[model samples]
Target: MSATKASKLYILDTNVLLHDPKCLYEFKEQDVTIPMTVLEELDDIKDRKKNVAQEARYAIRSIDSILSKATNSEQITKGVRIILPGKDRDIKLGCLSIFPDHELTVRTGFLPIEHNKDNKIINCALHLQSTFPHRQVVLVTKDINMRLKALGAGLKKVEDYRTDQLVSDVELLPEGHHYLDTPFWEGVDKVESYQRDGKAYHRVARTLLPNTFLNEYIYDSTQDFAARTVAIDQESVTLLDLGYQHLMNQSAWGIHPINIQQAFAMQSLLDPDLDFTIFLGSAGSGKTLIALACALEMVIEQGRYNKIIVTRSTPPVAEDIGFLPGTEEEKMTPWMSAISDNLEAMHEQDERPQSSVKYALEKANIQFKSLNFIRGRSIQNAVVLIDESQNLTPQQLKTIITRCGKGTKMVCLGNLAQIDSNYLTPLTSGLTYIAERFKDFEGSASVHFQGVFRSRLAEFAEENL
Candidate 1:
């Protein structure tokens, strides 16, 4: 469609394209404008060795192709239209020019004053807002403070790009204690189906009935039935297992439990309507495992997507590539190893062997990308899993989510408490920002796993640490 004919005009923020290379198509059928300044700004990032730079380059090439094709087509093939803001656009910039560009930032997007690149992008957003008055200009961003700054500058209608919102926290209570007299485990002959409280429970091949106190737990093989006599406190680890298994085994699809957070992560993944899913949990808590598992099932078994794309933030604490690396893959090996390890564990141990997962890694069918490099490509018909999402800046998260293509699903998993960045805190981190911003959307949901499930020592250290 002609740029003027489209009802709404969306000015491309530099951070938007940087977050997702395919962000050009996000406003499909709408008049999407990319200020010449934004493209110029991206040129600086488009050449770096990192993934972010690579993505910027990809976006530049993709958008350039679109512009070339649109030169002949009546409607813009891509949603973006290149334009240098005219007299009206300059007026807004003139008004905001008095304040330092750092002070004038996009609300709900990244504004890393520490990073010069981010500062200019924020300025570009403000400049576009100032320049366009006639169009219903909205600053779409993932930075909360940027949004706040945009509004404080008297610019109206800043919006969070969280197309996905989270489901409300479910209120649950632990009730019932194991009864010694009623513990009728007539064992070991044949497995029988069990049903309780209107739900059918799994029938284990074997059953264990330890000595029971008034509050001890018990399950019957004959029927999937068990309950405690009183409300169990959150400190009850045994109860969480019972509760978690009951919920997880219900379906391989939707939300299956690896730990408490799996439910929340699953909710986010399944809600195709939600724009993003953010998962946070400590190490060994099954955050990555559950995310990978769910993504695998969705893509391979459920036919939800064409492939699985995995990426993670490189912790700043590590040695720089120049200082300790051999080749690019050698440098990235440490960061991607966790993902490789998880895949190995997920496969049938004896049938394929651990090396099979490594072989699969070499195959082109799956994608393993660095967070710094994901900038420019649109992810379509794929299940995108972002690990260590806590390290991403709000602007970074915004960029990543906006690149999602039609039929794509994204799952973000990270540990807020384990964040390694100097500039962020527990609540201000990107994962926290996503959880708060998108908590209300029907297609999105957030879950914080309370108990650790990896091992006894891991759980103990998490509690103590």
Candidate 2:
């Protein structure tokens, strides 16, 4: 974000800092306030083993780094100069202020002191609002209820601190492909076509393309419809190398592509050159199923990856879990029930001996892991599948991705519409964040599935009630 010509005071909430530690620097030219209660909460959560705890430690360390440069307590409390690191230089030097919470009488409908962290945080915001009468005092938080209370308390402005949101409407996000939309068949003679591996490859000018990138699927619905976009250049695009598209119908653990999107996903998944790929779709979209099948093919059949490390954010989809038992894999089995179901379905369809899901997983050398235990580890020669990726925060996703070592491929699968975390929306979900961020990155491709091939019942339920 660029520095604003005008100034605004943004009060930080604990969740905001926990969600993103670098949020203090996001204000640019504006000032930021960190309430003492937020610091207290940070101190309490800094030692836990989860991502939030790590964020707390990071926020504290950042604050301490800035505070060490301040000469006096007055500067620390009143406000100290903070230089924001920019692309080439400092975007703008801003002030980082620390506000202490004071004992106060209970307002109507407010929680008491020493009991509610939310009330304490808002009380400090209330104090800041009164202090900054000349400037806008906006409470920045990821908590909807906290913002509502602050707004009810007559705070004129409150906003979500994340300004890097890609798309407000989920539908506005591109599907990685678009219909020909024009009479391309009339000019088909001019378009270059060649035969490769018993299938056809056609080339079209980039000007006629629909803002596509590497490996993005292109379709011609107007005439004889074809699929796949294997190569993209500055001036032209290459169409379906059915060499790989033909393999989509070939069995991968007894699974076949039901549509072109699945074929594209399977192609990317099985390709040795594509190191990173994403499959975005709704429930019963066959994303997880296809990823697992390809992982099995690469690891067990092709001997490409050492193993398959299947993982997902532990956040429940919609229900709640009281507790779980047994080993990490055992406890994680409930979370990975979808994976187990797909494996069983694939095994049942296979006619090979030892075709049970258990035998298939054993032969494939599959491992189930929680994202919590992945820190500081280099995962090499493995195909990692991060399911329910929408539940992960952006920072968490970055940490996981950075752990990928040489020969390791990571395929992130999630539905932007099924994000269940409080800190994320369709626009800001980690899945959506990576999809937009890696659009042009080499060896990385993002494919959005347009169909849910789980079953007619699932498709009907997804579309309707």
Candidate 3:
């Protein structure tokens, strides 16, 4: 494969690589160019103590593994062939090249390199655009401002890296449930109802709910019926009949659900068979509260799990918490305050609320782990609660999720609307990615809560603001 033979040339930005280290292989047959400035940035970032430092190291290794195949500097600059693994072995792809933008003598029509690293990157893309006029040269970056600046600097094509993006709109993501205006049974003409081991199930034609996924809840507006889709086949759908009253009356650690959405979330969290669960909602929507409550019930009351592991994605700049005084959990206290607040809320009615909170914390054997330190460990016999998951990229999420071992159930809770990562949007968030990707997995479930139960003021603000 040659650079000129490739259909398009894509110049990748540093953030795109950090967002997904394996993204180099995602651009099928399109040739890729890495600016010298991007390599410099990655080198500077790889030694840092932040979470992104790990990704930077991975990206550098990936680039090296591919470029090491080249025998000479000329071949490296011209382009090196990219060979994919396994089934893609026979497919011919384009090349990977390192652009020496720093050596270019021409300064005309290029952004001043001294302005900032962004400008230096845009200048590299601009130079490529002018050199490869016949090729569809595109600058792929996650930064919105960078894309705009590249276009302003005469770059013909600019795009956000969308190879990992599963959906263009967040609203199209699954809400974990389907609503019916009429009674569920009323819509189905042929239904087979049966009982097994004191549990009821209804089998209906798959066409009735063609778009439903495994573990998705099905309920009607009448408030009299509710069931979870446990099995789906080409011809029929199997629903485990969970009575509406049963779901509404469910309690975990004495915390009863205030809404049907919360009821659905609690059901999934409490189910012994569900190993992976996701909760998507706004602040004050009971995501953290419900997850914590269930974690306590499962760990302390039922003994289903030995302990609870709580972790979350900290801000990129603040991920280096070594400067903070105390042990890992103590250093994480500031960020994990929401967990404490929920525990306090659960014990608010106790005679000694503070003491009760302390006792519950001790009894549950909860450990506050850092996302930075969670890599490369097999966590067993635990219910892992991942908060603020919207801030994570797909690769980061996969790193954490893969740590789960036998007898472990992981619950990821995130408010997509409140994502803090500049490199992430709701459509490209790991929360959305896993929610959609795991919808068909029989052991996983997802629920999106719509109500805000924190307080009246909080509810009003969430609605209006």
Candidate 4:
């Protein structure tokens, strides 16, 4: 067998390409095959009025860019040599081919051609597996059910597309804070206390907390002390002393934190120095409430920002905002009802709750925006709140984040456990991506709220269900 056939063959799936368009070039030195059914699905999706349409177009473009290099249909079927972009262009990788699965004849052990798209793709893999019995033929997809079905259908190799997964386990992700078993001071061997610009700071040895990152909160079991890492070096870490009482006392739009996690989230939100913040938690953990309250305070009360730009990833089933009636904001209102709910919760005690929410909406200059229209526009002097961020991919998050111009504070809130995207998991989520990527940046902070304070039923559901 030729060296190209000796290497493993990876059959690409439609969902994998939609999840990450650059996936065509991700497999190093391994041949890739795209079945005709996958291309048909991409073609059908490319013109749709959803976010995935853009991804579909991108995947098509990427495939065309490489396959266009081939001079003949025979080369296209056999395989076209894969080339890496930029400095690595000289290094030869694997080959990419388009399999004519539509012309494939059904054989024994092959799934019925009348089966769904997934089964057809699996049939393509099974053909390749039989054609090259000595080589490994893997089906790469983001769908768990598809993987199971592929295996059950007798495909030996099936895997999820995990090239972007940062952590194997969700629990290994950073929580933005560390809880000390004993008093923080007791564990410290040496410390230098001083005042800088009227703020107290403690310079402690880096060995005290070797795993510390910028803006990470540290608190002890006593709940008497709380400090945020302001600076870190090889020798020591500078901590800004924030009294635990002060963090709890911090209020935004008349909302007070009921737990230390909430307090940490509020502190991160209210800090003027932080330009980016992330809140990761379960549903009913007050992520949206705290973020909305703080955005209102900053935009309406403090005048730190001119407006609040609220946007989120609509569920895959409801991504076609263009199909909805009225203007963009009107179309986005349904997906952003969580913001409205939080606004009402903030003003629930007022004599006119709906009137208060309406007033706050107008006064704070809050604008509901669809994620589709966010790209390529510079958002300035605004507090951008991205809800349901866990559903977004890293590329989508980067597109929105890069739109932040001067004097913009970006807040992302999401529950990893509540991700609705079939292509994403907690580890591969954009929220998790940014949380890990920005943990060491001084201007960013992350807080994971552990409590579900919406109601007793919600708390019970969060724990048990």
Where in model 4 is the C-alpha error above 4 Å?
1-6, 105-109
Strongest candidate by lDDT: 3
Cα lDDT, all candidates: 0.56, 0.76, 0.90, 0.89
Superposed Cα deviation of residue 76, candidate 2 (Å): 1.9
**Per-residue accuracy of model 3 over 59-97 as CA lDDT, tens digit each:** 999999889999999898999877777674555567899
Per-prediction TM-score: 0.49, 0.88, 0.97, 0.96
Model 3 regions lying over 4 Å from their true place? 1-3, 87-91, 105-109
* Candidate 4 local lDDT, 11-93, one digit each (tens): 99999998889988889898999998999999999998877788899999999988899999888888888787668456667
TM-score of 2: 0.88
Clash count of each predicted structure: 36, 0, 0, 0
RMSD (Å) of each candidate, 1 decimal: 13.7, 3.9, 1.6, 1.7
lDDT of 1 at 376: 79
